[model samples]
Every structure is written in C-alpha cells, then in structure tokens.
Target: MTGTANRSVERAFRIVDELAENGGGRVSELADRLEMPVSTVHNYLQALVETGYVTVEDKEYSTTTRFLEVGHRQRHRLEVFQAVSDELQDIAAETGEHVTLLVEESDQCVIVAVQEGPDAVNLFAYPGARMPLHAAAPGKAILAHMPEDRVQGIIDRQGLVEMTNRTITDPDALFEQLAEIREQGYAIDEGERIAGMVCISAPVLDKSDEIRGAICVCGPQSRIDEKRRDEIADIVKRSANVTQVNLDYV
Candidate 1:
C-alpha cells in the first residue's frame, strides 16, 4: 500500500481504538487526542459511521452495534473455552493452582478465562490480562504452533525483555525452545516473567486441526516441584484435549 494510504488506515484504526478505550468522546476531544484537525476527525468519523463501525449521538461518537456483532462472532467461535470452564475449575481445585484459558489476540496473548485455586496465593490470573507472547507458558504454547514468519514478526515487534533471570533473552534460543515445546505438545514457564512461579500449558485445536488457544495451570515454585510439574503438564494436556473435543460438537 502507498504510504499515505497506510497512514490513513492507521489513523482511522487509532481513532477507533481511542474511542473503544475511552468508551465515547466528542469530535473535538478525539481530534485533540489524535493530534489531528477536527475536520479530519469528522471525516473519519463519518466514514466509520457509513461503514456501521461507529455511531454518533449528541456530538459524541462511540462504537456501534456492528462492533459488538464482531465481538459476538469471535466469542461464539471460542467454544473450546466455554466447554472446558468447568473442567478447568476442577483442575484448579485438584491441583490447588490457577487455571487459565489463553488465546492469541493478533500478536499478543490474552487470558480469556481463569479459575483460581482454593489455596491463597500471590499469583493473579484474571481474565483480560495480557502477557508477552514468548514469556508465559500459555503464550509460548500458542506461539510454538504459529508459523515461523509470524513468530519472527512478533519477536521483531516486541523484543524479548528480561522479566526475570529465567526469562529467555535471546530470540534464537527462544525459537529452539518453541521447537521443543511443539514436539512435546506443551510448554513450560520455569520462573520466567514472574519469579517463584511456574506454569504448564497445552494447546487447544479446532476440528480443522488449527491451534486456537491454550489451557494452563500455574502455581508457586514451592508447590510445583519436579514431580508435580510433570503431573501438571499431563493434566493440562488432557484438559486441553477435552476442550478441543467439545468444540467439535459446538
């Protein structure tokens, strides 16, 4: 695409993202935030309105029902997460660890659902939390199944930052680890990103045999020792498989 055309598209998307983040805003407010002329913001808003992506009322613009429709479509397709919510709760209860469902959102990994264990723990696995694609176990599991070029692009965009001593700082080493995780059909976070925490994750695949998301169990390093680690991996893989199976019916 031409430079000007790409810039326009980026600006349009920026406007939408800003509105989505702020809930709603007047044209002047949007123009000030976007650092563009009010006329330009009005033109963009008009285009978005024509496309049913945004709606304006009382001189304030907000996302339209069309945006909710898109979100609904995406959520409907996430049958696997819904199918295994109960099973994940069981896993957390059985293991006394946090169980989470993670899905790839563009180049990032987003936690869609979480079930905390009975035991009081410092770790927080709340839904809507985002993690680095290469650092966390669920994110690594999804990334392991992605194409090489796509993985490279993620690394290029979000250069691996050292979150802890165990975090992988080298891109080449991370790729090697991803290869191993793909072969094993699971991934591990050994004190990476957060110190004193360990996570095991397995990928969920659709009927088309495409990786959709991952199921994970995370806990403190003190509880998840060498033996418990293997047990957690096995349970996570089984839970992920069950979720994938249920998606077939849904």
Candidate 2:
C-alpha cells in the first residue's frame, strides 16, 4: 500500500480512540490529543460520520449506535455460541445443575457459554472468565483430549497452581487422572477447583475427532454426590455428543 493510505488508516484509528476515550471530542481537541493537524482530524471525523460509524452533535464527534448493531450481529455469527446455546439450557434444565461450555485457550480454560439451573448458587465463573487447566472438570475434559505437546507446554508455562487441597499439584498424578478421564470419556472435579463443589465434564469432539471444547455440570457436593456421579457424567456425555453432531451438520 502507499504511505499516504497507511498513514490515513493510522490517523483514523487514533481519532476514533481519542474520541472514545474522551467520551466525545471536537476536531481541535482530537488533533491536540493525537498530535496531528486539526484539518486531518476533521477529515477523518467527517469520513467516520458519513460512513455511519460515528456521529456529530454540537460539533463534538463520537461513536454511533452502529457499533451495537455490529456487536449483536457478531455474537449471532459465532460458531461455538450457535452450537451450544439451546443445548446448554436443555442440559441445565434436565440435570438441575449449572451447565457451562469451556474451550482451551493459551493453556487455560476459557468459559464460552453458561446456563444456570433453577436452584442456582453464587458461581464465581462466567462467560469470558479463565480458569486453570488442571483443576476444573471442564479443564480436565479439555486437557485429556489435547495433543501431548500442548499438554506439556501448559505444564511448562503454567505449573498447576493448586486452588484447593484436592487439586492435583503433582504433574504425575494429574497425568494419571487425565488417563482415567480418557478411558471413562468424562472427567470429575470433586471439590477440586472450589470446596463443596463438584463438576462433571465430557469432551466435545469435531468430525475430525479434534477437540472442539468441553461441557460441564456443576453443583454442590450434596447434589452431585457419589451415587449420582455416573448419571451426571452420562448426561454430560450425551450433551457433548449432541454438540459435535450439531457442529457436523453446520
């Protein structure tokens, strides 16, 4: 690209950021903040206003409602959100427990979607939150399905920081648990991430058998007890399978 085009793009972004940070900005104020000429700032502001991405009122420029429209459209377009939206609600309703979808990102568990049960407790986790990859049931479900190199990289970078006494602090023990999870097709977190909480998770796979993500049911130990462990795991496994099937169809 030409130097003029690159510089214009940079100046436009600076103008937008300056306006956003200051709530609104006049051409002179934007120029002062960005250390660019007032005429250049005005040109970018006009372009933004004309494109419907920005608006001017009382000679001040700011972002428009177009951003909200873009955000809503982007949320609906997410593949993971589409795959799990209805199923998470169904799983929560069926099991009477919290349902969550987690994906592995940078060796950590990132919550992508969540559905609370009727008797919801004060869960610390939520969508967009990150958790250690060695503690939660959803984390184990993801780790067990990850490639060996990826698992090793996680261990090297983020040594399993024990959140509770039950959390696997030893690398060898964690690997053993992952092996068991692989064999059983589900993982269990019995007061591991948080005391008095038990979570059961199963891996969601794609058509290529690659790990897509994990689904979990979380509740207090009394509700997710020893007698109900397998039952909860079976339900989780079913939901996971349905997610994969949905992905395939998509």
Candidate 3:
C-alpha cells in the first residue's frame, strides 16, 4: 500500500472511533478532536457515509447499525465465547455478582462480555473496554499463566501504572503476587484498580493449554470479606474450569 493510502485508512478509523466516542458529531467536532482539518474529516465522513458505515442528519454524523451487525457476525464465529455463555449467565444469576470474561488484546485485557449482578452497583465494564493487565483481577489471572519472559515483555511495554492507592506499583511485589496467583490458580484484586472494589478471577485455558482468557467476579469490599473471598474465588475457579472443558469439546 502507498503511504498516502495507509494514512487515509488511519485517518478514517480515527474519525470512526471519535464519532463513536462523541455519539454523534459534526465534521468540525471530529476534526478538532482528531487534531485534523475539517476538510479531511468531512471527506472521510462522506466516504464512510457512502459505504453505508455512517449516517448523517442535520449536519451531525454517527455510525450506522452496520457496525453492530458486523460485530454480531464476528461473535458468532468465536466458539470460545459461545462455550462459556450459559455458564457465565448461570454464575451471575446464582451469585448475584458481576461476571466478566476478558481476553488479552495488545498487551491489555479487553472485556468481551459482562453479566451484571442483581445488585444495583456494578463494575463499569463494556465490550472492548481495555484495562491494564497489571491492575485488574481478570488481567492478572491471564498474566499469571503467561511465561515469565512474555509477562516481563508486557510489563516493560505497559509499565505498572497505579490506578488506586492499593494498586501494586513495585515490579518486584507485582511479580511476587503473580507467583502466588499461579500457585493458587486464581487472582484477587484488593481494591487495587477501583476503590472499595474487589475482584476474583481464574484463567480459562484452551484445549491446547493456552491461556485464552479469564472469568471474573466483581464485588464490593464488604461483600468479599476474607470469609467470602475464598468462596468467591472457588466459584470463579470452577466456572473457568467449566468453560475450559466446554471449549475443549467444542
């Protein structure tokens, strides 16, 4: 591809993402957010509209439903997600806790699905939301199983940035925690990423013994006290195992 084509593609995607973030936007708004000229944004928006990927009304542009249709088509192809669908729903129903399945993407953990609990308050997890692997329970679960060299590589690229006061900031301490998580086959976040938020997660492995993702349960500190922590951890571990077994069969 020519350099011009590559840049055009990048700029087009930036407009798409920025439009999504702002919900609906004028060409000038998108141009300002992307630090590009309005003419460039207008040209890309026109192209996207012509391709039926975007819609415009009253000088405001927004993505079309085509994106969700494409996403649904893509989800149908991921057998791993299908395998754990029922189990995730059941776990959330029984425990009345927020459950999430996340996969590693670009050295970060991206939430693929979420089942909100009966409780009113829930973790702010959305499909495609990315969290640092060093900060979240689900991320730690996958990170723990990763080879030390690979884990180090991720840590090097995405330094252990602190999200909360309790977050593990020291590299050595974080490594130690990963070791413990590996031995126990589960990972825990003690108000690390979000204040008063506790999460327990277990890794979901594929048929080939590769870490595909993780199953996580999120709760408040009061609910996940020491006594219930083990209980929730055990539940999460079992759920992950069930998903893995189902994946193997699929």
Best by TM-score, which number? 3
Supply the TM-score for candidate 2: 0.71
Model 3 C-alpha lDDT per residue in residues 95-194, reported as the tens digit of each score: 7888888889899998888888797255667777889999999999999888999999998999999999998888899889999998999999988988
Question: Which stretches of candidate 3 lie above 4 Å from their native place?
Answer: none
Model 1 per-residue lDDT tens digits across residues 1-250? 9999999999999999999889989999999998999999999999999999999899989997787677657765677666775887888888888888889997888888778888736565565678898989998999888889999999899889788999998999999999999899899998897898888999998888788899988888888889998898899999888888888877
The lDDT for every candidate, in the order shown, is: 0.87, 0.86, 0.87
lDDT winner between 1 and 2, please give it.
1
> Could you tell me which residue pairs clash in candidate 1?
none
Stretches of candidate 2 off by over 4 Å are: 1-78
Q: Per-residue alpha-carbon lDDT of model 2 for 1-250, expressed as tens digits?
A: 9999998888888777677668887888878878888887888899999999899999988988786677557546656567775888988888888889888877889887789888756697766678998999999989998887789889999998989999999988988899999999999998999999999999998888888789999998977767788898999999889888888666
- The clash count for each model shown is 0, 0, 0
Better candidate number, 1 or 2, judged by TM-score = 1
TM-scores, in order shown?
A: 0.72, 0.71, 0.94
Query: What is the overall TM-score of model 3 with all chains considered together?
Result: 0.94
Error of 2 at 142 (Å): 0.5
How far does residue 189 in candidate 2 sit from its true spot (Å)? 0.6
